[model samples]
Target: MITLDHNTAQRIVDRAMQVIGHSVNVMTPDGVIIASGDPLRVGELHHGARHVALRGESLAVDASNAEQFTGVRHGVNVPITVGQHIVAVVGISGEPAKVLQFADLVKVTAELMLEQTALLELGQHRRRQTEDTLLALINGRAVPQSWLDRIGFDLAQPRLALIIEPAQLPGPDDFVILLMRQLELSDKSLLLAQVAPQRLLVLAPIKPASTTALRSMTEQALSLLQSSLSANVHMAVVIAAGQYIEGSLQGCYESALATMASGRRESPHSSVHCYSDDPVTILWESLRPSWQQQELLRPLQTLRAHPRHLLYVRTLQAFFDANGDVKQCAAVLHLHRNTVRYRLKGVEQLTGLSPFRLPELLHLYLALKSDDLSTKQ
Candidate 1:
C-alpha cells in the first residue's frame, strides 16, 4: 500500500516549506526540481548544492561568501534517503537558523511523497522512452502505428533527406521544426531533425501523386527562404532524386554531405550561387598569364601620350563623371577656372573624343570600365 500510495508532492513541499522562510525547493536525485515555495523557482533546475547530491548531507552558506550570489537567504540541502538510497533532496531557503530546525522533519515528509512520485515518474518516462526508441527503429511507423504514435514519421510514403544550408542560419532548430509543421497536412509529411549543428535532415515524403507538384512547391519555398534567410547560408541543394529506399538513405546522406562540401565559400564580390548540372564548373579551369592580360588593352596605347596630354584626358573624364559640369570638376580637381576649360579643349584636340557626341562618349565609357575591371583582376 505504501509503495502504491499517492500524494500531492508540490502541496507537501508547499506546506513544509511554508514553515521555513524566503524560498524553498525539493528536487529529485537527478536534479529535476519537484516542487518549491517560490512560484518562479518551482519545477526549475536545482543546481545550488553539490554536497547534498554526493554525500547525502546538509550544506549552509551565506551570501557574503559569493561575490555574485543574490541575497541573504540561508540554505539547507537535506538529502531524502529511502532505504540507504537518496531518492530526492529538500533544499530550504529562509532565515538561516529556522531552516536548519525543520531540516530533519522536512526530509522524512518530502522524501515519502518524492519516493512514490519518483517511481511513478520513472515508470512513465521509461515507457515513453521505450516507445520513442521503438518508433525510431521502425521505418514504416512514420504513417501511424497505434502503439508507436510518439514520432510523426510518415511510413507509407518513402522519404528523401534534404540538407538546408541557408544563407545566414546560425542555427535554425526551431525554424526548421516550424517548416516541418507547415508541411504536415499533405499526403507526404516532412520531419526536420538536426543531423549536425548546421546540417538539418529534412525527411520529405515521396508520395506518387506529390512528386512534381511538391518539387515545385519546395523550390518556391526555398526561393522565398533565400530572400528571407539566405544571408546566413551558402550551401547548394543536393537531393537524392530517385526512389526513397532505406538502403539508399546512407547514399542519399552521403550525397547531401558531398554536395555541401562542394559548396563554394562566400566571396566578397558575389552574394550567392546555386548549383545545378552546370558545366561551368570546368569552364574556367585555367588562369590567364599576366603577360596575356597585358595584351588586352592594346588600343589604349593611342590615348597614352605626353604626361600633360594624359593629364588633360583624366580631367576630361572627371568632368564627364560630374555630369559635364566643368566648374564642379575644376573645383574638385583644384585647377584654375580657365584651366579646366583649357584641359577639355586640349583633350578634344589630342584624342578627338568629343564630350557632346553620344557615340564617342560610349567608347570612352567602355574604355574606362574595361580598364577598371582588368586592373582589379
Candidate 2:
C-alpha cells in the first residue's frame, strides 16, 4: 500500500487546480488535509474526504449539509485508489453539481502520478540493491547464503569478471543496455552494473566449453564493445584461471585492474587488454615496489637527476634489447655506432656498471625495467 505524503499531495493539488480551475484539497487516508488550494486548510481534517475514503466511494457535500460535518465544504470528494486500495482522497471545492464533473478526472490524474512515482522509486531501490550485491561480490565481502538466494543470484557458479573504464561517463541504464546488446547477452547469465561514476563492472557466466571457444567469445565481445562505444571507452577483461567460484572474484578483479594499468602503460593504442596477454609484466609490477630501494636502482635514480640522462637509459635498453650487438643497438636507436658506444660509456660512468659485462648488463637491465615501472606508478 502506498501512502500520499504532503509533497506529492501538494504537487497533485497544484496540477489539479491548473486543469480544473477549482480549489482542490488532497487528504491522506485518515482525512488530514495534506495539501489544499486554501493554504489555511492544509493541516486541517476534512470530514467529507474521510467519509469518501472510509466508504470507498465519492461523496458530494452541498451547502445545505455543509454545517453537519466538521471542516465540511460545498464540493465533491472522491477516493484516490491504487489498484483496489484507497490511498488518498481528492476534493474539488465549489457547488456540488459544478465540481462533481471534475472530481473523477482530478482523482484519476493524481492516482496515475502517484503510481508512476512509486514505480520510479521502486526501480531506483532495486538498482541500488543490485549494485550492493555486485560490490560485495567483487570486494570479497561475506554475504549470507539466504540473502543471495533471496536475490536469485547463485554464487557457486563460474563467472568471468570484466571491468569497463569509459572515457566519458554514460548513464547506468544506457551503458548496461548497450553493453548487453553488443555482447549478445540476452538472459540472466550476464550481470552488468556501474560500481563507480566512470567504471562499470560485469560478471558473465562461463559456459561449459573449451578455452578456445571462450576466447573467441571474449574477442567477439571486445570487438563489439569497441565498435559500438567508438574510441571513447577502454575495456579490461580478466578470466578466472581455476575453477570459477565465488571466492575467485577478488583475484579476478585485481587481475583486471592490473591488466588495465599495464595496458595503459604498454599499449595505450589498444582499447582492450586480457590478463593472459601479459602476465609477466603484471607480476613484476606487483613486485616492483619492493625493489624500489635495491642498490641496482640507486645508480639509475641518481642518473635521473641529470637533464639528458634518459638518453643513456634508452641507449642501455636498446643495447640490452639488441643483445649487446653495437650495430644492432645503433640501428634500433637510429644513431651511429660510435654515438651508441659513447652513450653506453656515459651510462657506465654514471652507474658504475659497464653494459659489456654479463653481470653488470643484467643489473642495468633490471634497473632500467624497475625505473620504467616506478615512473608509471
Candidate 3:
C-alpha cells in the first residue's frame, strides 16, 4: 500500500531492484527523471528513454550514443506506456543482453503500476449528480489521503475538471480513469477524479485572480486528450468544458452538460463544439427524436426544391450574421441594397413569411441545421 507522499515510481523500481539487484531510473509521465538510484545522475535527462518512447520502439542502446543518455554509465531504455501514448521510461544501468530481462521486467512493472495508480486516482474524480459532491470527494474523503499524498495535492491551487466520453463507445471504466489520472499526473491539472461512471473531474490550481488563464488551460486540455486516445474505435469524442461555478468546482458540471449536448448535436465530423457556442441547437437534437418525419426537415426540403430558395437561405444566414444591417449584408453579397431588398421580397413571396417574422426566422434556422441530414455526407 503506497501511502501519502510516497514515490510511486521509486516503489516499483525498488521491486525491480530486488529482482535485478542493479541501479535503475524512473521517469515521470512527462519524460523527466523522477528518481534514479545512482546518486551521480539523480537529476539528468533520460534522452534514450525519451527516444525509444517517441519512436514507440523497445531497443537496446550502448556507449556509441552515450551522450544521448547524458553520460549515464550504461543502460537500456525501456518505454513505459499506458496505452499507445508513452507515459514514461525506465532505464536500467546495465547491458541489454545482461539486463534485458530486467529492463523488460521494469518496463512491464512500471507500466502496470502506472495503470493501477491512474485508475485509483481516477476513481477520486467521480462527480455525476453535480459539482458539490464532486468537489467534496476530490477534496475530501471519497479519495484516500494516501493517494493525495502520493501526488502532493494541496488545496491552494485552482483546478477544473473536464469530462471526455467516446464518440462511438461504451468503453471500459478503467480507460477513462487512466486517461484522467494520466493527464492529471502529467503535472497539468491539480487532481482528477472519476465521478458519474464515464465522467472525470479535474482540479486546476490557479492564481488568486487568474480565472481566464485557468479556463484557457481547461479548454486546451482537449488536444492532449485527443492525442492520447485510440483511433481504432469508430466514435466521436465528446468533451465537457469545465467551468468554476461555485467553490473551486464552480461550473464544471454545467460545462460538462453543455459539452455533452454539443457532442450529441454534432455530425461526427465535428471534433469540438462548446455548449456556449450552440446551446439550443445542441439541445434540440437530444430532446428525444419526434418520430414524425415532418419534425425532421420539412422546412429544409421545401426550401431545397426552390432553386432560388437555397441561394436565399445562404444569403439570409450571412445577412443575419451581420446583425440585420442591410448595408453590411449588401456589401458582403456584392449587391446593391436595392438588390438585397429585391431578394428579401422574393423570399417573402415564396416562403409565405416576412424575412423578419419570428416564426419564419425560427423555421429558417431549423432548415439550415437539418439541411445536411437528408443528403449523406
Candidate 4:
C-alpha cells in the first residue's frame, strides 16, 4: 500500500543521515514529510519530493531554481523505489551540487531499509502461520496440505511433544525465540510453537534414533533453559515430554498435557515430568474409554454423593499424593493424624475401597485421578 509509517521513515532518515552528514527528509508519495533529521521539517510539505515521487525521477534545487517551489531547499530529492513502487521520497539537504552526489546513495539506502522491513514482516507472518498450523495438528484438526507443506510438517514422521508451562515470563513470541535459541544451543532442531499464552509445544523428531535418545536431548535442552531463565528472568517453569507417535500428533500432545496436569495435581513441587514417569495414569486420564471411565468412577460414586464429598475427596487425594502416609497427608492438609485416618476410613466406607490396602489403594488412586481429569474436561 506504500504506507510509510513515521517510525520506519525516521529510521531510514537516521540511517542515511549518518553517511550523508546532512539533514535527510523522508516524505510520503503525496509529499508530506513523515520524518526528517531536522525535526521541525517533519509534517511539512516538500514540493520537490512530490514532483520526484510523482515523476519517478530525481529533482535538484539550487539558488537559481530554489524560488520555484515554496519551502523547498537546495538539495536533491529522489524516489525511494521498492520493487516497482515508489513508496517514499528521500531529500538530502545541503548545497545542490554537494547533496546531488548523495542522491542515489540516500535513495538506495532507504529502499534497502524498506526491503529489509518487508522481509522481517513476512518472516513474522510466516512464523505465526506455522504456529497456527502446529496448534491445529496438535488438536487433531485436519490441516490443509498447503499449510502442512509450507511448514514442512510430516504426519508420517514420529515426533514427541513437549509441553512447557512458564510463569512470570515474557510474552509468548519472545519466549518462543528464547526456547529456540536454547534448543539450538544443544544442536537440536527447532519445531516449536506457543500454543497458549503461558504454554509452548515443541515437536521433537524421533527419526531412526530411539525415543530415549531424543528424550535425553530434550531434557538437556530444557535443563539449559531452566538455568538460563533462573539466572536472567524471574520465572519458574514446568515441562513435560510426551511419548513418541507417528501418523498423528493429537495423542502425543494430549499425553504431554496430561503429564503436566497429572504432575501438578500429584506433585506440584516437581518442575519436570516425562510420559514415562507415569504413562499408565497419564494415558488413563486422557484415553480411557467411556465405559472404562464410568467403571472407574463407580467406586467414587457414593463418596461423591456424600454430604462431605469435597472433604472426603480432598483427604483421599492428599493421602495418595503423600504416598499413603497418614502423617504426611495430615501435615499437608493441616489436619491431625487421627483426623486424616478418620477421613480415610470415611472415604473407604463411602466408596467401598480401602485406602489402607495396596490393591484397593491403587484402585482408589486411579479412580481419584480419573475423576479429576473428568471434572476438568
Candidate 5:
C-alpha cells in the first residue's frame, strides 16, 4: 500500500472538492486524515475511511450512523486502489445519498493521477542512475562488471569520442534525442550523455571500412552536425587513431580535449576539427609560449616595425612555396624576377640569414609557422 503524504493527499482532496462542489477529505490506509476541506479535521482519524480501506469497498455514512464512527460525517468514502491493493481513501462530505454519485468518479481520478506521478518518478530515477554510470565510465572510474553487462555496452571495439559544447545548455534527454536524429545513429551504435551543463560527450564505434570510406563517412556526419547545431553553437570533433581499445578511452578523451582547445585557438570559425587531420597544429599548440618565441622568430620581429611588414612576410612565404626558384617565386607573387630578387636581398639584410642557405631557409620556415600559430592564439 502506498501511503498518502500531506502534500499529495491535500492536492487530491482539493481537486476532488473542485469537481464535486463539496468538502472532501483524503485519508491514508491507516485512516488518518492527511487532507480535508475543513482545516480543523486534518490529522483526525476517520473510522469510516478505515473501514472502507480494510473492507476494500465503499462505505456510506448517514446521519443515523455518523455518530458511531470517530470524526465521521454524513458522507460517502471510497477506497483508492492501485492494481489490487487499497492505498488511500477519498471521501465527499455531504449527505450520503447526494454525494454517493460523485464518490466513485473522484476516487478514480485521484488514483489515476497518483499512478501517473509514480511512473514519472520511476522514469526520472532510472535516468539519473544511467547518467551516473556513464559519468563514472568517462571519468576513468572502474565500473562494476554487472553494470556493464546490464547496460550492454562493449568497449572492445575502436571508438571515437566527440565532445560537444553548446552555447546554451540543453536538457540531457533533448540533446541526446536531437543528436541521434541529426547523426542518424541508433541506440545500439551510439552512446550519448551530458557530462556537464554545457558539455555533451558522445562515443560511437568506428565501423570497419576502408580508410577513405571511413574518412568520407566521418566528414558527412560532422557536416550534418554543423548544419543542424550551428544556429548558435560551436562544435569541435576529435578522432583518435584506429585500433583503440577500452583501456585507451581515457587517452582518447584527453586527445579530444586537446583537439577542442587547439581548434578554438586555430580554427575558431570552422565548426568541426579532427585531431588526426592536423597533428602539426595540435603539437605546436602544446608547446610552451616561451619555447614558441625562439631566436628563429627574431628576424620576423624586426620586420614588424616596418610599414611593409605584411609585404615582406608574403614575399618570404612565396619564396618558400616556390622552393627557392626565383622565376617561380616571381610568378606566384605576380612580381618581376628583379623585384623578387630585391625583396630576398632585403630579407637577407634585415635577418643576416641568406634565403639561399638551406639551414637559414629551414629556420625561417619554422619561424614563420611558429608565428602563424602565435597569431592564431
Candidate 6:
C-alpha cells in the first residue's frame, strides 16, 4: 500500500501553504495530523480531515460546524488519492468560503508528487534487479529460477556482449535515464546495466546465423546514442563487441572488456570496435602467460630506449600497415620516403630485426601488438 511518510507530508504542506497563503495540515488516513504549517497542530487529531479520509470526498468545515468535532478547524479538507487509493487528507486552514477554491489544486499537486515518488522508487527497484541479473548472467552463476523468470531472461537465447566506455557522464541516475531513453532499450532483446561509473554493459540478442544483422542493429543504436549524448555529455563514446555467448558467458564478458582495451590501443579514433575486426587481438586477449608477451616484446625493448622511440615505432607500424610499401607508408605518415626508410633502418639497427626481412618484420609486427596488449593489461 502507498502511504505518505512524514517528510513527504511536510513537503506537501509547505508547498501548499506557500501557494495558497494559508496554513496547511497533512493527516494520516486515520485522522492524526502528520504535518502542519502550525507546528502545534501536528500529532493532533484533525476531525475535518478524518471526515474526508473516511468518506473519500472533500469536506468543508465552517465556523458554525467547527464545534461539532474535536480538534476542529474552519478549513477545506480534501482527500489525496494516489493510484485509486485515498492515502491521506490535505486541509487548508482558513474560512471555508475562501480556502475551498484552492482545494482541488492542492489535492492534485499532492497526488502528482506522490505518483512521481512512486514511479522513481519503482524504477530504482527495477534497476537494481537488472544489475543483479546481468551480474549473475555475465558471471555464469546460478540465480533462482524464479529470478530468471521475473526478468524474462532466456538463457538459451544467444547474446552478443558489448562494453561501452563513455568519456564522461552526468550523475549516475541522470545518465541512466538518458541512456534508457536514447538507446530505446524498452525492447526485451536489449539489456543494459551500468557496471561502472563511466562504463555500461549491453547484452543484445542475436539470431542463430545472422551476426551481420545484429552488428547492424548495435551500430545503429550506438550511433543514435552518440548523437543524442553529444550535445549534453560526450561524442566520443567507444563501444566494443566481444564474442557471441555460445560457450562460456564469463569468457564472453572478459573478451568484450579485453576487446575494449584493444580498441583503445589499436583504433582509438573509431567509435565502435569488434573482436571480428581483428582476430589477432582476440588471440592476444586469450594469451594467459604474461611471460610470453614479455618475451615477444623483448625485441622492442632496445628500440624503446632510443630517444626517437615513438618515431621509430610509428614508422614500423605504418610500414607494416602499408604492407612494406615505402611510398605508401610515407604517404600515410606525410613524411618523405627516405625519412621513412631512415626511421625503419634505425629500428632495425636498435632491435637487430630488419624491417626489410619478411621473417624479422613479422616478429617486429607481433612485438608491436604485444607492446599494445601488455600496456593495456
Q: Tell me each candidate's TM-score.
A: 0.30, 0.70, 0.43, 0.68, 0.64, 0.73
Worst 10 residues of 4 by lDDT: 226-235
Name the weakest run of 10 consecutive residues (lDDT summed) in model 5: 236-245
Full candidate order by TM-score, most accurate first: 6, 2, 4, 5, 3, 1
lDDT of 3 by residue, 222-291 (tens): 5545455556521545566544444534345555565665555554556555554554554454343445
- What lDDT is reached at residue 29 by model 5? 83
Question: What is candidate 1's lDDT per residue for 205-275, written digit by digit as tens?
Answer: 54443543544533443444334333222342222121233535544444444334334331322332222
Report how far off residue 88 is in candidate 2 (Å). 1.4
lDDT string for model 4 (195-236, tens) is 776787877665444655656644654554454444433345
Give each model's whole-structure lDDT. 0.52, 0.72, 0.61, 0.78, 0.71, 0.78
The sequence of per-residue lDDT tens digits that candidate 2 reaches over residues 31-93 is 889999999998898888778888999988886788877778888889998878999999899
The weakest ten consecutive residues by lDDT in model 6 span 167-176
Per residue, candidate 5 scores C-alpha lDDT tens digits across 1-377 of 34457888888888888888999988888888888899999888989988998899898898788888976988899999876888889989889889889977998899997887677566455556656777787678888877766556776755666677542234344654455444433344555566655555666666545654556544544544444443433433322221223466665565566667776666666556676666555555545458456775888877677788788889999998798899999999899999999988888787777888999987787788788877766
| CA lDDT, candidate 5, residue 295 | 71
As for lDDT, the candidate ahead, 2 or 5, is: 2
Judged by TM-score, which candidate is best? 6
Candidate 1: how large is its RMSD?
17.3
Model 5 residue-pair collision total: 0
- How much lDDT does candidate 1 score? 0.52
Q: Between which residue pairs do clashes occur in model 2?
A: none
Q: What's the lDDT for residue 65 in model 6?
A: 81
TM-score quality measure for candidate 6: 0.73
